[model samples]
Target: MRCAPSAGAALVLCAATAGLLSAQGSPAQPEPPRFASSDEVNLLAHGLLQLGHGLREHVEHTRGRLGSLERRLDACGAACAQASGTAAPPPAANPVVGDAAAPETLRNLQVQLKAQDTRIEQLFEKVAQQQRNLEKQQLKIENLQSQVRLLAPSHVEHKVIKPARGKRLPKVAQDGDTAHNASRLHRLPRHCQELFEEGERQSGLFQIQPQGSPPFLVNCEMASDGGWTVIQRRQDGSVDFNQPWEAYKAGFGDPQGEFWLGLEKVHSITGNHGGRLSVQLQDWEGNNESLQFPVHLGGEDTAYSLQLTAPVASKLGATAITPNGLSLPFSTWDQDHDLRGDKNCAKTLSGGWWFGTCSHSNLNGQYFHSIPRQRQQRKKGIFWKTWRGRYYPLQATTILIRPAVDASAS
Candidate 1:
């Protein structure tokens, strides 16, 4: 991926001496910040918010300048028009001029007037170009602000859950090993597991292929299990589904290779509610792909009835996709998460890490999740293909999708 230049690059456009002083002041002051495990998420959320504020302020400044230039141009046009209206009163009969001399002087005056008109046109053109550039930059700044809000916990909700049918699943999955193909999903087509796993904690591509068909709708949601800390459920579900859930138009080769439900958990720096992620899919018809290994939210693991319609087979390389999201990659369960008597309250899924469950500071206390330091530097593979060559990194994040009731029937 191409690394973008830092914001400092934008400052160079201002006056050179002012930029130098600003540059000196910046280094002399404290550095912007390098995310810390203790508060990475907050830093990011807050930093973006601050940037949005700054951009809005600059946008206002540019708008004000444009207004001033517009007024001056209008005045210049008026003066030019008034001068033209004064039919040159027969130049006071040049007392010593031959009628030819009068024409020469008038011609010189006309040349000056033409030059002035040309200069005004050039000025207007320059102003118009500036206005367009300012507008483009404003649009970009606003877009970035919207993304900041998306990553903010206060603005995002998680989507989660799925079900199982006939067989029995283990009481709990191994906290340390999720790669063991002995898992049920391994026996299924490879693409099933690949898509789900790729978006784990945010790594996968969801292209919205329409092929003159209905547009598939996707949304994400977050939930708190009655007894499990968001972290514990994330780390210890026997029926885990941390895999990426991908969507392609019908008949995309019936999926490939092998796949499985993968689940993992991560602790918030502040240790609030632990996060849980699961990935499982079903078509409109009746094909049960990963029915053997189910994924879940907070409830008991049971077969979720999902129906597959006529399998949609798309032309070789055509499938529309959208963003499905990702989940955290680390496990959060441990001895510290056990809640003794509080059966009604939610417990931590990841245990005693900074944000897991404990009697004093419960997981349900506040929904704030901390951004572990170094996470920004870690590649989550979570990129959204907003368009070609436009992959927006998922950064350190999570995606949860709740399947429809009928989605489990198959």
Candidate 2:
């Protein structure tokens, strides 16, 4: 490559050496221009490939002159030997006064040669550095391509599926309807308490997506204190609560009226972030009472078991209530998860519940408009035994939950 400065250097070296050896006076040569910096050296490499031909011609002319001077010196020595039989005086001793600056000129030429060589080496180094940088950039691009290939399949598998407008959402099957509902999750609240905090004062139906669960519609009960998510209600005999395992597991009914929010959804809400459960009951005589408990409901593997702490608040007057059914797994007519061995509490009481040797409170029991005169028939009606006897059926009942307002939840 012309990157090497050898050609220009040969010209300078040849001219300088010839001037010194002949002990001859020559006109001072102009100094070659030097590179300002390494960057300029690179720019020159692109503009020009070879040193100037005029410089080469000048070096050849100097070499020829030096050869002529050598011949004349040889002839003069021969002539002196014949006349006085003595050798000619050494050329250095007979040096002309005009040749005094030959050594200095040679030194300057040598310095210029060395400088050009250094600039060429620097240019070579810069090229190598740029090549290394390009190689590193290529490696980075390859790594990113590999990552994209690894993640491509997952992107296709989990692609968000938007539901058709003006249609009810399909039932939770695989991923619990997460694929179709995920698009709306960002706009929907996670629970009724979140809605109340967002300044929703009116009680109505709203879509919610609990953590790890798909979005679904629920009725929000907006009270003065906060909002409550209504999970189950028995206002009228509109929706039957006497269902098997699958019906309760998948939930049934509407949010505007009486409905039971599915067991899986209740687990999603209460299991991840615990909640406070409130049971409100009204007797046929219009006597209303309520009870509150800090609760956590388990998942389907645990039969959606209920876990309740002591009642934090109760309006049962002086009634001594024992929360016996709090720790039991839920039971249904088909799949018995209750503790009772001989008879399924769900079959005996004609409804579903978390029952241990039967229940003290059976909210899912059959709705009775009036008090049953037969003692056996009363056990089939909705009853909270502490406030009212088992035979007295309730007029209306609501089961709601609000996120726990403790430090752990925060």
Candidate 3:
């Protein structure tokens, strides 16, 4: 093996190489940059400041809208409270008192109140949405401020700017939405529930029965599914009988809608007896109008439907003969009367009251004509003529259907 160079000789050679390299004069390396330039930092800060100002303006505008909605809501609440506090006038001592116009006035007032309530509810929803947007804008402004602080130069003094304050937003009306969803899962769809609520508020109380029969009170309530429920209540407020009726908004002019009453309830109350049923409506003007329809069982179950069309002048005069010898003007469309075989009772009629099968027949009148003309018939009473030649008074329930109206409008 070759011997290694001695330590003193290696050190002398390294020193000579360093001195030669220094004499050549190589350039020195520069240090890398750690921060952005002053101009770039200033530009970024300016952009952040503009965004912050825009957010502040938006927040102020939203607050103004929120305040307006709250004021409207307060007004609606006052109107609703006033409506509920007013009591209905007491009934006249006379059972046959007439107030035809009062009913209509009361109905209109109720409709207006309902409309106001609905408008308030819509405003509440809008306010809640605006509040959520305001929160998001605030958060954005905060983020922009943080970025500005990071980019700000050390020599430049930075001051924090606070957002303007406003009134606290009311809690959102989540209960209505939750209840609406829950109702759909169990009872009725959203549209139907609205119909039912409106109908309940608009229905009127009436006394209904067949000719010569004892009158029974029928309370009408609108179902959630846009149907009518007629119930007879006892003195203790318990229901005696109940009937379901379906109503559709059809026709034009005087008669605006139609109500369908099934034959099952008629059969239950009158049995094999046959006669005409009368519905007494007390108007706001203290005048009472009687709506009459023929109900003959004919030993079979058949459905009966009535049209809400204007009554013909010729038929109205003939049907206006009431038992009390008073002739009231017939304004409503009469029920369609049609006979199948020996079934002399009225079947379902289409279009106008006089447009059906019994148009030319002897029973073409508003009330049916039995074989014996001597039978006593009263327009305001419920009387049923049985096959055994005996007349019995009926106190039964009847369901009336009308077209579904908007809860707010109705």
Candidate 4:
């Protein structure tokens, strides 16, 4: 097989050929020009020598780098073998011989080295891309931090105002005093004063003592049905029936329309069996009847209520003249019977004033006697029972009364 000469050997062969050609040139060929001085020739030779030295140094550096790379690749191969749980192959023999096969092997090694260099360049590009991505993410984080700083103050402003522990806070009235007074005036139905007077007169007939300071505050109104309803019961030292009387009266009165009278904070005395249960009626007035009948305690829920009907004066009988000169003759249903003219109205045997059915009579067959259940806890608030049997708290400090609507109209 034939082999190509190396670069240095080829250069030497070319120089020798040129010398021979010059010596064998024909006489007709013109002689080439020579340097004018030996110093000029020497200067040119020095330049060539320097260039050759530089080339040699570059070649040597390249060889050293290539050797280092080979060593590193061998080390990496061994490590990969170890990681893979395999024995490394034996090292290949060096191809330093001056033969065609040796040259071919060297060329193959050069091609492998170039391929490794290209793979290394690709890895460097990936690292650069990852670094750029990291920088972009860092910039985004900084921008978000700046936005949060800008919005922090407004968020703090919206924070809720928490009250101090173990301290009671006074309620802030939504409507001012003037507005409240205006609302009261607006809610007052026509002929409210007359209804208030009638309730007071009837209460006196039953010997129902007024409770709380200024016992009577004429702030009630007449309902659409001409029935009187309590609007507010703000008397001191009394249980405030904050609900309007019209709401309770509507449940019993005739659908076609009926008159009702409500008294606020009347007194009641009850004698059950041998035990006596006395409670000051919050907003009811009817009779001063006393009972000696056997009464069960805590067995059943029973209450005493006062039902006053207007336009039923004929059923009530003659008006009883009082010392105060307030003549009010209204029918009153107490316990189970009508005590309009019963002289023993204050003294009874089995019934006096209870919400349950009485053998004597049920007033006009209207069940209008019910006192709200007192809360077991000592909370100073009122709760109303809904039809669904749920109790909801109320902040009723005022009473409101309006005329009852006709049943037909409703």
Report each candidate's C-alpha RMSD, comma-separated, in the order given. Answer: 23.9, 29.7, 37.7, 36.6
Off by over 4 Å in 2: 1-185, 310-326, 406-410
- The lDDT, on a scale of 0 to 1, for candidate 4 is 0.30
On residues 93-134, what C-alpha lDDT tens digit does candidate 4 reach at each position? Answer: 333321222333444665777765554445335434544654
Candidate closest to the true structure, highest TM-score: 2
Lowest-lDDT window of 10 residues in candidate 2? 152-161
**Candidate 1 segments whose C-alpha is farther than 4 A from its true place:** 1-102, 151-305, 308-410
* lDDT, candidate 3, 1-410, per-residue tens: 01112222333443564566455444355456345444544554454445434433543444455456445544455444455545544554221122222444444645654554454445445445544655565566567665554343211112332211111011232554555344333221112123344233333332233223333322334334443433111111122111112221121111111222233333333444333334433222344344444433332223233222233222333333334332111111232234233332222211222122222211111222222234343221222221111222223213232322332132
Per candidate, the number of residue pairs that clash is 79, 0, 28, 17
Model 1 clashing-pair count: 79
Q: For each candidate, give its TM-score against the true structure.
A: 0.24, 0.51, 0.18, 0.17
Residue 153 lDDT in candidate 4? 18
Error of 3 at 376 (Å): 35
Error of 2 at 300 (Å): 0.9
| Models sorted by lDDT, best on top | 2, 3, 4, 1
- lDDT assessment of candidate 1: 0.27
Task: Estimate candidate 4's RMSD in Å.
Answer: 36.6
Number of the candidate with higher lDDT, 1 or 4: 4
Per-residue lDDT over 1-410 for candidate 1, one digit per residue giving the tens place of the 0 to 100 score: 00111222222333354456446555655777643342443453454445445534544454454456445444454444445534334555541222223333445644554554454445345445544665565566566654554332221223212211111122344534345424543222112122233232232222111122222212212223211111121211222222211210011110011112122111110112122233222222322221111222221111111111121101111133213211111112322222233432222221121121121121112111222235332112121121111112221222233322232122
Residue 315's lDDT in candidate 1: 13
Say which prediction, candidate 1 or candidate 4, comes out ahead on TM-score: 1
User: What RMSD does model 3 have?
Assistant: 37.7
